[model samples]
Target: MTFTPTLSLYVARGFLLTTLLMLCALTGLVALFDFIELLRRAASRPSVGFDIPATIAALRLPFVAMQILPFAILLGGITAFWRLTRSSELIVARAAGVSAWGFLTGPGLVALLLGAIAVTGVSPLSSAMLARAERMDQSFLRTGGGMSSLAGGRLWLRQADRELDENGVAIVAGRPTAARPADPRDGFARFELKDVTVWRLSAGDSPLARIEAPRAQLTPGTWVLEEAVSFGADRMPTRPQRIELPTELTPGRIEDSFASPETLGFWSLPGFIEVLEQAGFSAVRHRIQFHSLLATPILALAMALLAAGFSMRHNRRGGVAQMIAGGVAAGFALFVVDRISAEFGEAGSLPVILAAWVPTVAGLLLALSLLLHLEDG
Candidate 1:
């Protein structure tokens, strides 16, 4: 490589390394604070284990790195450009027939490569780890492992009897937890509930029969309600009775309720969207997230362009201090625009793809305009 290309490559590599180091340091400090808080909360809870705190800390690093990437890119690019100007390396390259655009190619290529890695590789890993971390947090924090969508927590279904077309059953209970208990035939697939109430619905949806119980456990195809009270269809109170509920709901089905589409990676978003539609839930947020992931590279490139446009002027024309100030101002302005666009996108006022990409495109255009003015003028 020529001196210009070599210098640009060196500067770009240095910037990448510096940005990654700064991001890791800042994220590590924040993670330490978060871990301390998590540990304190775990200490307060009697049954909660220390494993959750460790898991949370482990998951936070990747998330923080993702969040800080744009800022790091901007700052690192500015630092590199500032150093080149200070050393008069850019001037030397220009004297040797290197155009401003020519010098930028190396760093731009680096940005593109980094952006690709972030979207395809880092994002999936982060999403998976974050999902696991969320589950751990919930299990350690909530009761009954939280409610599932399809089954487990007080399921109510109306079934018709053979003789009369009456309402079937209304089930309510405390502690309707789902777990895979040991079963002979099915091996291991069941949903169990404790402290259950089953109400048989009569004509006009009136409660015809009510069964109160201390425990009800669901097996592969059956629910066993124990220590229950039975009421007659005549709306009269009967003596205590126990019964079995015939149903197909299982623990896996219940767990599916808590599995959100956002927990999936970018690669899984399309399939997840199909599943969401089949399940009757909207996938708007997931679609937006996927688009945002695709836009990450463009956003990083825009930040670098903005930094260079604002900071990489010749010192003879503008002092180094002024250039640095201008760069900082430009970065902050871009950040504000990005935030506004994100809010608009989130509120559905703007198209998701447009909102995610507009700021980046705007920044790149602005930078190109400035570069043309500086170089050709």
Candidate 2:
């Protein structure tokens, strides 16, 4: 018998509601743990109140929900299918000539819709909230205030000069790259900045001097500027072939100052990645995030299929609990594979596309194979 529109709607509604309910339950549980951790950290800071941790937890919930959505979809689909099978609704349809795939179509479409909404709508809002959360974290929780700023496709870094007893700022035209000869001074020339401009400020907050260089390298406790020109308040502009300025900044500190990939929205990532790469920074993490977002919908659909494959068996053939457990295990296995592939992708050992899409595609194929065996064997 053909699966009517009414039946499809029934299945779709069941899938949607169950998925939403599961998502809420999982997100709430995760948020509670996160809030507790934040609260614990806040306790050490006399200036922080309960409201600050609570606010941060609230802001982070949406991003956490998105991460948990796939498992919710899997469990929701399993519950939906298990219910239909136990009620003999699906079994009756099957006995009357309807195929498992017929009923699966509705849930699959709903899963796709959910995934699309998450990627195009929810991600942007969550990313914005996450960015705000990071700002609050840095301002209130971290020892240092903001140390870096990105504008007009340039990177700016703030540093304290202990040796000179002054504060300085630098603008970098491109990303920092590995410096040659590795700075024998301390092996600190791990990275070098390009098209650099440094500004030193006096104790009174006035500009003490301005230095510009085509290339600059970090060595132990100072910045070595090559072919630099210096402008000072009391002297005519002087051109120096090499100049060394005392600094407390290191390569690791500068890298840590950059914004994380998660703070940028999906729609904004492409442009941001372009600007980062143009400025000579590594965009690998951003590229992985973009590809992963693009693959979310397909992964959702695959999760639905896997759920159905595991839970749509006849009631007479028991082991329902075992089957459901298997589905959950499979979901976790997919998650582990995704993380491993992502690590490889970040390390440049795997292509970004394969790292992002391989697990989703493999899950879909495996689900199809299982369903085929059950339907025709």
Candidate 3:
């Protein structure tokens, strides 16, 4: 028998309320612990107010929500279904001709709708806030002030090489100053590099000149090299020229490099990947994240099936404890597989789409098998 619109609405609302409450409680607990840790770290630094800490905590809420949403759906669906079973509601519905799949449609639809919202709406906000929070935390708490002399990360800069007839050049520094410049072009920023590699590509084509420097310092739109050697198109180092590499490049331009995939939001991953490819950077991680974001609905549905398949058996069987244990184990195993697949995708050993969707597909198949065996065998 098909449920009426009113009854479906009621079931959906009930499931949504239970899920939201569970998610809120879990997210709040995690956020509180995270905030306390941030506070403790902040205490060791200068007197920065609660703004950064609060912002970091607030920004982290959506990520926490996203992370716990599947578990919440699993637990809440199981709890709701278990209660219905224990109270004989499911039995009554089944006796009235409602099939298991029919009864599950309401909650499954709710999970799908919520998953869409979480991916499209919540993800961008969470990503933006996370970026801001990291910048603030790094600027105020970790750096102890504003920008430092020595920073550890990849730095990229574009310069002009008049001697090589190269108008625009790219330089990669192994380690550079974390110092924030008042102006993007101000070259007074100082950095000590262990190994510096400069790529001088043609104005519109291949590499024309390459340089390696033991160390370098920025001096107002120019880089001064110490113990530097230059390589030409023939792959031979010319006589060491104490030359001034003239360019409009600045410390700010060098420090604006983007690498970490986490900084890009789900909504922006596609565009960002396009930009990355055009700029000659690998977009594997972004591809994985994008596919993973698109698979969220399937993941949520799998979670629901996993929970219901295990927990919705008749109480007369006395397997509720076993069902709960199995559900938890399945969820954790799926998580581990997902992480391993993600690693493989990042390492280019697996296709991004396959890596992202494999766990969801596996969970769905397993849950469906279990459900069919229990309900129809």
Candidate 4:
């Protein structure tokens, strides 16, 4: 209430410490839950190692911590403010002429700072670790061994052949030079592969021919191999101007096969978006993710403000149980809204920026309204 620098620092430190404690507790709980689920999955698979679950749990703690920030900030702010109120410290400060706004300012700013750190410092680390954990977990669940991960510059795919062809089956390996997502409207999710290597195997699993091309595109029914060089078992390697290799891989299948956007880091998102757009893909999912990361700090600040609004009033005027329940419910509701909006954003059902920020902006506005009403009344 006195608006003193020392009082503000004390409030900020108390709130931050509480938030960190809650974060630690929540992360440990999440890790435990994940470990139990992993163990249950490993029970049926003899190939899974005991160390794999532990490693996955350890690697995923960062992601869990990042996910819990908004909730931690809300709970921490509520705890700190409720303590101050019950102890009569806040009342005494108010009597001493400090406004509610003055005290809440420090906590609000700290929440914003925590949000910034979550996005810029923790997000990339968490995303990368989660990606690796998922790949390993998926492999153990599905294949029981070996890496089954897919996402990034290099790619390998087996061409599915339905018809009997004496020429043999083809294996495709290459760097993904470009991609065009299905323009369902146009019926094509065209892609360009660079440094392409193709091996046609005989019925006995022997290599029949090795074909290399500078570029290749799988169209409706054929692989349009450009500047292709073909080497067969019994003949000299021959260069072809353009060769059409039979294939059944569709654009939708190729689109579905790419790595999920979640596996990519926040720092790398912009460049990835550019490349995706250049390759003629929609890049909607990446754009949504990037915008969501940018909005995280503001979301935390909104949660803090909402918590303060619910917990800062004089206790004598209200039902303590109801107030606490209401505050928790509001925090959860915001989280649900944010997730639903993100889903809409990713699906392209809503405009990217709007989907990422609508819930956050709405929460902030509601908090501001509550604060203003309290200040005026």
Candidate 5:
């Protein structure tokens, strides 16, 4: 009954195990459902083999697990605390003058630590896999990638072409500028750009030509630019009524290249945000995502507190179910609020900091209030 280090470690160990179990269960179930959904989508495309959907679903699991982590913490905390109470371990601890907060400190810290690890370690892998999954989904499952991004009323895309030199050395033009290495599997597709500017580069990154157009539309395999003008290093600018350029970009690929903030790793976000803003695109969503990730540890602590509030008590008839239901409802309420505030922040209706931290703050306050009421009253 003593609140010794061994006792606290035991409690924390139990909580971590349960949380890991819950995460695995939830992630596996979700992945199974996702695989089925992908299979259904693949049904229409006879050429898409079974492996395509399976691979995509597997690649998507990490992102899904990230999204489900908070829920796993809530459920796991509830189970762990409920077990302690049901087994009279917490009851004996209370009889020994150890308050609820004393034992909960271990699990709360564990949750907080796990959240930090997820944000810093797991996020990068999840983002990369999510990006790859999106590309696969676009290429294999869908006819088009998706709607192209018009961030801050501008879009930036880079295209590359390769040629063999006389000595058989390969030269690349318009090299990729993304943080990650370009995937060799991506194929060329038609693309359209607005307020488009094309830079033609040669070996050693030397500029060859520059083309600017107000509007460009995709044809079968080319971009047709209207009111086009060209500039070269040694020649004066020439305006053309219309110009055609070959491309290997599709709307979907363009959208994939300009990935959403969620698909960029946490460490990569700041740089990508800077790139977006420098390219005349809004970084509001990326800013919101970054701040939200920073808030995850606090959010995890709140969930643990809330779970302890509901589940750490003397067992009463029919009370366990009620506490479980209430904890679940409260957890989901926090999630809904977080999503809503995020949307508001992205829409500029709320400050990014406020939107990102409000849910965590509110959850912590509410959980603390509940714990105080149960403990002191």
Candidate 6:
């Protein structure tokens, strides 16, 4: 059967319109809930006024949009195909020797293109906004104001160096302030942490040496402290011009401590991963994130095809509810498997590439098999 370009464009136009409307509706609902949550958090902090929640919600909207894009595509595809089926337009085309696969090609490609645009274009803006929102939230509405210096962040990692002292405690504070750094450039994130405190403990975790430094930076395998003051158990407190402390923690690990992979844009992830692995930290999570983003376009296309397969049946042979339900169930199943695989990847039980790509491949194959039965059989 010859598939006409006119038909393809017509189908693509309808699908794109529906997808965009669905995106707007879903994005608005998400923003409303996020605003409420931010408002609740801002209640106790005087620095955050009523307007802060709105600002935070706006900043977070793109990330939320990215999260729900697949579902939006699914629903949009279903809506578009079902509308055509109900109006008998698709039936007419089918009667004229048009195949479901041919008719679906346009919408499938459109979905894939949208997915790519989301990952490449929208993601960088979303990442930047998300990072800003997180920082703003921490600054204004964070609980435990002064001692928050001691509180853990989302990227917190604890490394024990037995060689330094069995009972020694190191307190690292501050985030990396660097921006758009290349992988080989002093591992920019390592220089971002400031205000370091080290405590030397005796047999029972009693303090033996208390070192306070205004600025501390993590290097390859050591912490360089500037203008440090040391207070010993028996000796008088002494001022040191520079104190270099041996550390098992690497720059990669320190970089991982400040920001999550999602908070970094797609363009920065590869360089950041290199920096992470070079400094002796695990890059599994970053690699997983990168591969997952790389798979988004194909995943979106699969979702579109699956949605059409589920909802394109003739109304004369009803069961729309069941078909749509099955599609949603399949989507949720894919999500669960992806989460499980990611956990395994992060735990180093599974290879990063396998963990990231397995769910995507499985989803696509499953959708393709189901569509073959529905479309060809």
- Kindly report which residue stretches of model 5 are placed more than 4 angstroms away from their true locations once superposed: 1-3, 146-257
Model 4, 41-83: lDDT tens digits are 8889888889988888888888889888888888888888888
Candidate 2 residue-wise lDDT, 198-249, digit = tens: 7776545567777888888777767789999888888577967799876556
Pairwise TM-score winner, candidates 4 and 5: 5
Q: lDDT ranking from best to worst?
A: 2, 4, 5, 6, 3, 1
Per-model lDDT: 0.70, 0.81, 0.74, 0.79, 0.78, 0.77
How far does residue 25 in candidate 3 sit from its true spot (Å)?
0.9
Q: Write the per-residue lDDT of candidate 6 for residues 243-274, one digit (tens) a residue.
A: 87766665544534456778888898898777
Better of 2 and 6 by lDDT: 2
**Candidate 4, number of clashes:** 1
Winner on TM-score (1 vs 3): 3
lDDT (C-alpha) at residue 137 in model 3: 74
TM-score of each: 0.69, 0.75, 0.76, 0.73, 0.76, 0.77
- Candidate 1 Cα errors over 4 Å, as ranges: 1-4, 46-51, 141-176, 181-262, 316-319, 332-336
Local accuracy of candidate 5 as per-residue lDDT tens digits, 1-377: 23567678888999999999999999999999999999999999999999999999999988898889889999999999899989999888887888777787799889999899989999999998998998799878877434432344444554443332111211111212222333356643434455667776654566677777776775554667789888878757896769776555444434533677778888988876665553335788889989988988899899888988888766665587888899999999999999999999989999999999999999999999999998886
> Number of clashes in model 1?
0
Residue 122 in model 2: lDDT = 95
Better of 3 and 6 by lDDT: 6
RMSD in angstroms between candidate 2 and the native structure over all alpha carbons: 11.9
Worst 10 residues of 4 by lDDT: 144-153
lDDT of 1 by residue, 255-356 (tens): 433465345677877776665443334556666777877888887787777667766777888687887788778877877987798778878888978877
- Give the winner by lDDT: 5 or 6: 5
Global CA lDDT computed for model 5? 0.78
Checking candidate 2 for backbone clashes, the offending pairs are 175-279
| Model 1, C-alpha of 139: deviation from truth (Å) | 2.3
Q: Write the per-residue lDDT of candidate 3 for residues 272-334, one digit (tens) a residue.
A: 676555445567888888888899988888888787787777788798888888898898899
